[model samples]
Target: MKKTQWFDFQNFFYKPSLTSSIKPRPFTAYSFVPFSPLAMLDPTILTIGGIVLGIAIIERILERWGVIDLVDQFSKIMRFILPVTFYGALFYFFATFML
Candidate 1:
């Protein structure tokens, strides 16, 4: 037979002992430990990293084929055209629907 002990009222009021092995730590923003890769394992960061890697690989291929100049020229034209197109679309959308 197993031994049973009665619960004591004094045990309920007792606090953690100072000589205990476990220590309390301060709260931190990140749940992961410091310098851990899990801290930077967010989906958004992973997506951005993948996009940067893809761009770098494409740039290398373009450079190897000597077609980087074409991309540079196209990017220059796009720099001017994209903002105008975006604003024109925004203005038309606002005029037609947003009032």
Candidate 2:
């Protein structure tokens, strides 16, 4: 017996080339508005600094209210973790916004 040829295959295939005759709309010319680097710098710095300052203030408030003492058993571990987490978050926010 002879094997059937693969070229005999058929299916519901759509051809994109059928729309090749249509042309796309031309782009319009517009004025170029230059970005002010100083404007971008000020807000980004303020946001990152505000976040860090807010974290520090909250931590101090919690410590003053004896909250830290309540967790005395893990005080040392928390002291280490707090700054690292705050700074990491600050840096991440700054880097993301800058990009």
Candidate 3:
């Protein structure tokens, strides 16, 4: 039966107080815009790639010097290794702690 403040539209239409306009915003601060880094290396991927690349380089040198060709069969094996290692570790951690 009463027009309470919850649905009162008249009170909502308020003018800004003169004191608020004169008050300084002490906590006003500038925001920072982040920039992209030059090189973003994934530790696991890059380490694996580096090891593979090193083996490739060594094979190249050995072939040039006539020693051994190195175990060159598993060059692209990281596709399997990376996923298995990451997911296996994740599953292991989840199973160990969560379940």
Candidate 4:
């Protein structure tokens, strides 16, 4: 009895097929409409206006409910003081190290 190779596997793997279903399509790179920067303005205004409006609404509700009065004045004073102290420290560090 004798054994024989049925096919060349290398040629079968590398060769392109005649009945290939994949084909690249032509693409257009032009458009009829022009672009504008004004398109971005509405969304920017909407987001900023929404944040400001939300803050205003919350402040108004707090004022109406007298919640602001319930908070001690010292805590309100420290809110501004703490950030100022942090900014001063940051400025001092940057001035000493960066300059």
Q: Which prediction has the highest lDDT against the true structure? A: 2
Off by over 4 Å in 2: 1-41, 69-99
TM-score (C-alpha) between model 3 and the true structure? 0.32
lDDT of 1 by residue, 22-87 (tens): 789997675554345454565554565575556556666777899979768656765775566556
Minimal lDDT window, size 10, model 3: 33-42
Error of 3 at 88 (Å): 11
lDDT values for all models: 0.62, 0.62, 0.55, 0.59
Q: What is the TM-score of each predicted model, taking all chains together?
A: 0.37, 0.32, 0.32, 0.30
Which candidate has the highest TM-score of all?
Answer: 1
Q: Supply the TM-score for candidate 1.
A: 0.37
RMSD of 3: 15.3
lDDT of 1: 0.62
Q: Which sections of candidate 4 miss by over 4 Å?
A: 1-5, 22-43, 64-99
Estimate the overall C-alpha local distance difference test score of candidate 4: 0.59
lDDT of 3: 0.55
**How would you encode candidate 4's per-residue C-alpha lDDT over 1-99 as one tens digit per residue?**
699767689987988888869788998898554544454355544555565556556656767778876334534655775566556655654454421
> What are the per-residue Cα lDDT tens digits for candidate 3 across 1-99?
987657346655674454654666678766473423323243554565676567667657766776543434433554556577667655654454421
Runs of candidate 1 with Cα error greater than 4 angstroms are: 1-36, 71-99
Better of 1 and 2 by TM-score: 1
